[model samples]
Target: MSKDKKRADLDEKFQQLRSMTNSTSANKASILVKASNHIRKLKDKIEKLNQELGSTSTYPNTENEHQQDSFPKVNVETLENMFTVNVESEQNCPGLLLTIIQVFEELGLDVLNAEAACNDGFELAAQGVWNEGAESLDAEIVKQVVIEAIRKWMSGTASP
Candidate 1:
C-alpha cells in the first residue's frame, strides 16, 4: 500500500480506538477485551512504521539520503509513576547532559537526581519529578524526545 493510504488506514483505526476507549456504554467482557486487543495491534503497527521511517532521527531528509546518525537508544524501567531514563550514546559528545537537563526544565519537571558515566561511554542516569497533579505522561512521546535529542547531540548540533 502507498504511504498515504497506510497512514489513512492507521488514522481510521486510531479513531476507532479512541471511540472505544471513551465509550460510556456498558460493554460485555469479550467486547472490552476485543477492543483492547485491537488498540494494542494498532500500536504495534505504528511502532513498526516508526522504525521504518527512522522516527527516532531528528527528521528524515530525502536530500541528504546518506545521513548516518542513528537515534540513541533508551530504556525506562519503573515500578511506580516515576521513570528512570538511561540514555546510551556511541560518540559520547559534550553538552549532552546540559541539553537533557534543559529539556526536563523546559517541560517544568524538576531534576531530582542525575548521574552519568565519564568519557568512556555516553550514558545518563536521571530521575525527574513531574507535577504531582499533572496528567499522566505519554510514554511514546517521552521516548521519542530523548531519542531525538540523542540523535541531535550525536550530529554535533548540541546547541541549547
Candidate 2:
C-alpha cells in the first residue's frame, strides 16, 4: 500500500482503539492494553514515514522541539555590596559553580559566599563583592560577564 493509505489506515485503527477504550464494558482494561499497543505501533509507523521523508529529527513527531530548547534559564543580579547569579537548567552541569568562581576572579570580584543545589536540573547562586577600587564594575557589567562566562562554559569553549 502507498504511504498515505497506510497512514490513513493506522489513524483509523487508532480511532477505533480509542473508541473501544472509552466504551463502558468488562473488557475495558484489555481494550486499554490493546489501545496502548496500537498507539505504539502507530508511533513507530509515523516515525518510519518521517524518516523515509528525509526528516533528521530522532524525537517522535508528537514531541515539541521548541519546548526542549526553552530550558537552562540564567539570571544575574548585583546588589550594592554583593552580586548574585542564578542558573536553572534541564540537567545538572558539573563544575558550573567552579566556573562561576573563576569568572568572578576574572572580573575582579571577591567571592564572599557561594551556594549551589540541584534536583531536576541545577540552581547556582553566587554572592561576591567587587574588588577594592574597581569603580568601573557595575551590576549590568558584572551580570553580562557572568552570563557570558556561563555561556562559554556551556558551549565547551571555557572550563572551570
lDDT per model, in order? 0.60, 0.62
lDDT of 2 by residue, 1-160 (tens): 9999999897676566656335433364666786677567646655554454345332223346664453355666766556776767778777776777787776668877767787667787777776874422445455555555665676687774
The top-ranked prediction according to lDDT is 2
Name the runs in model 2 displaced over 4 angstroms.
1-71
Model 1 scores a TM of 0.51
TM-score of each: 0.51, 0.50
Clashing pairs in 1: none
The ten-residue window of minimal lDDT in model 2 covers: 53-62
The collision pairs in model 2 are none
